[model samples]
Target: MEPFQWKQAAKGPSLFYLSSWMEGEALTAGFTGRDGGFSKAPWQSLNMGLHVNDDSKTVVRNRIAVTEALGWPFESWTCAEQVHGARVHIVSASERGRGRDVREDAILDADALITNEPGTLLASLYADCVPLYFYDPVHRAVGLAHAGWKGTVAQIARHTVEAMTAQYGSHPSELLAAIGPSIEDCCYEVDGPVISKVEPLLKELREGGASMAPNALIADANGRARINLKEINRQIMIKAGILPTCIELSQMCTGCRTDLFFSHRMEQGKTGRMASWIGMGRGEPFS
Candidate 1:
């Protein structure tokens, strides 16, 4: 069965939840869909990102709706100003609610956010870029990372794991991870420029005992290849010592499911973004 279960709230935003993880623990982990918000036209309804040319007030409203639907307060939402870099920010209690309403206050120049602080939700915006989630049940820490091809090549996945380990003393082997919805290989084709950069990273992962699916990065005679970024990141996690059995992969493709997800590639770069979030209160071991 697919890990992310789709649910439409009666008066709330459409969501794809990592329900098994939420049910077994105090954590709430999921990705937002492209419906049930108040944004108009290209971003019509359920747009959770403020940087996508959506009105600030409407974006805040949509964010509030998501918080309410999760039974969490809006003040608990913390965001990152992603620059496609590998910088992983460690969020604490003092950092709660940054960028909940505006972009200026966001944790700047970071693509990954990790926190062991309870009640502080970690969120990042995504259109076609992959969302990488991390949870260290050993240290009660949760993390979220945004990975476009740039961030992926920068090794954002491995950096997130290292950050959690360094800050929370989290052992990568004990981490539970999830690769959220994004553009899969079927709809993600890249030319030589991108391929040149990604090849080195894939080569390193391969040398480190990390394997990739055949469709993960397929090349054509024309110098372009269909890349499964999600799988590539998964291999990165493995290279970083995260157990393969502990990782969950979402099968929903943003490009094919544009009706449910906002796909930047499919929409010609004129689309809103979905948000991936994960947080939990202080708690005991995973149930």
Candidate 2:
């Protein structure tokens, strides 16, 4: 399928929008570009990271607009103070609005969140980490995962699938997945240490009609190997039982699309966060 369209939101400064195509229920999933909120430059408008050192008040206001646009209550959204780990929190009705509360221990160090509860928004913050959205139309359940290179090699996407199967009785054949906007291979370069972790999973691509000879490694200008993260994680999902036709990856890269996204690498550790969030609709899809 073609990539989702990006549009400007007239309600604020320069907000952009994203939508997914799993061809089922009224579920919404997308990432916020660096716009439409109350934060200052570098943050620009909608900077959603609570720990990004942006003014807390601005972050709160931006989040409110996000939920409002999704037709969800501002208080019902859920998120984590992600620390680039593989922890996944299974959200429930009892834990509704937990991320919006003042508890310091609100699902500590989690990098992923999944829930079947309609109207509950599950998401994680990122500038370059891949955001993976999961939906089982047959089961009417949805999940979200944050995959950095570390998480991808750890098979977090596979773990998410297994979690859905065990927790919500979701079947792999019935699931639809979308890997949201993040750093693409064009802008993501790595060293031997990182390549060692990704090599096993990348064997498929090495054989898939690329310019390289089989069993040969390709390095960059600086002589460091680069890996295609989207391809690697796609393998993880397929290995975990998702059909090849059920997956989508963003064509846009945050590190490359500087005007539209916040790239932590491009910004040199001083940038705002873009959020990838998913929520079940209010019985029916909303415009």
Candidate 3:
């Protein structure tokens, strides 16, 4: 079964809940779909990013809807100013609500956010980029990362795992990770310039004993390689010491499934963004 289960409502925002890791009341982790809110076209409904040209108030409304669905307080929402870099930020209680409604308040220049702080809902925006999730049940830590090709090559996944290890004493082998929806090899073909950057990374993964899929990077007559970013990222996690059995990979290709995701590649450059969120809650609410 797909760990990220589609929990669609008749007339509300469509969400992909990370069900496998939600067995306890202490954590909430999942990705959002492109529906059920109130933004106009281009960003038409459920746009969680405030940086896009969408109306800031409307984007805030979309975000509030997701928090309502997750039953988390809007005051706990936290975010990072993603720059496709490998920088990581640890969110404490003081940083809980930063960037929940505005762009300038986001954690500066961080592509990954991890927190052992309870009630801080960590969020990162996505369109076709992969959403990497991490959870440490023993230390009660959780993380969210946005891995575009640049971030993937920069090893944002490894950085997130290491951040949790250093900040909360969480071990990579014991951490649970999940790679959410993104463009797959079927729809993501890169020319030589992009392939050149990725080739050396793949070389390192092979040298490190990563079990890459045979089709992880397929070559064609045009001298371009169709890259399997999800698998590549998975192997990167393996290289970072995360156990293979503890990782979950989603098969929903954003480029192929436009009905469910906003594909930046398939849609050219105009589209809304989705939110990938994770947080460790304090306890059961009195409400």
* Number of the predicted model whose lDDT against the real structure is largest: 1
The segments of candidate 2 whose C-alpha lies over 4 angstroms from its true place after superposition are 13-24, 101-105, 203-217, 221-223, 283-287
After superposition, candidate 1 runs with Cα above 4 Å error: 282-287
C-alpha lDDT score of every prediction, in listed order? 0.91, 0.75, 0.89
Q: Write the per-residue lDDT of candidate 1 for residues 1-287, one digit (tens) a residue.
A: 78888888686799888887877687888999999989998898888888888898999999999998887899999998899999999998999999999999999999999999989999999999999999998889999999999999999999999999999999999999999999999999999999999999889888877767888799999999999999999999988899999999999999999989999999998889899999998333232
The lowest-lDDT stretch of 10 consecutive residues in candidate 3 is 278-287
If scored against the real structure, what TM-score would every candidate get? 0.97, 0.88, 0.97
lDDT of 2 by residue, 1-287 (tens): 44445655587533333444523447777777886778897787778887877887788788888777666787677887777667777888887776663326356777778888877888678888888888877777888888889998777888889989998899998899988788876788888788877776566544653333332335767758756666677767877788888887677888898788889888888889888877776534524
